[model samples]
Target: MARAPTTADAFNAVAEPRRRDILNYLALAERSVSEIVDALEMEQPSVSKHLRVLKDVGLVDARREGRQMLYRVNALAIRPLWEWTTTFERLWRHQLVKVKENAEKKTNL
Candidate 1:
């Protein structure tokens, strides 16, 4: 099957690692492109490209602040991603329980 374009949806857009990093950074607070580049240790152009993809998918919001454009995560747009992942929460909890049980057993041995 052909791969969907990055702009197809939030999932496709965030599939890229750099875009995920951008989202994580923006989650803390809105920031300028230069700040993202500096904090993430990525080139300005690369950060810009990832930001564009995120914006296209509605996962990010950008606005001008004086001479700089600030970017932030759109929590509403990310809701679907969060909801989808949460469907697997039970599985994750089960795995964690198994790990804890194994560790306790080892300690008791």
Candidate 2:
């Protein structure tokens, strides 16, 4: 089966590393296309393309500020992603505790 495009949903949209980076950058503050491009060290077209995918998934909001467009993360839209991933938090903590216990045993040996 062919893989769905990144614009399909929040999960797919954020699956791309570059898109995740873009989201992380935008999380701090709104940024123009050029600003994203420069901060990410990506080409202008590439940054714009990622922004378009992010927008389609509702993970980002874009607004016009004079001739420039500013983009920011849509926190509400990202909640689903956060909720889904955090479901594994407990499992991760359990595993970490096991590892810590084993390390402590070895150090005492």
List per-prediction Cα lDDT, in the order shown. 0.93, 0.93
Residue-by-residue lDDT tens digits, candidate 2, 1-109: 7999888899999889999999999999999999999899999999988899999999999999998999999989989988998999999999999999999999999
Backbone clashes for every candidate come to 0, 0
Tens digits of per-residue lDDT for model 1 on 73-99? 998998998999999999999999999
Least well predicted 10-residue stretch by lDDT in candidate 1: 14-23
Q: Which ten residues in a row have the lowest lDDT in candidate 2?
A: 1-10
Candidate 2 residue 95 Cα shift, in angstroms, is 0.9
Report the CA-based lDDT of candidate 1 relative to the real structure: 0.93
TM-score of 2: 0.91
Q: Estimate each model's TM-score.
A: 0.82, 0.91
Candidate 2 deviant stretches above 4 angstroms: none
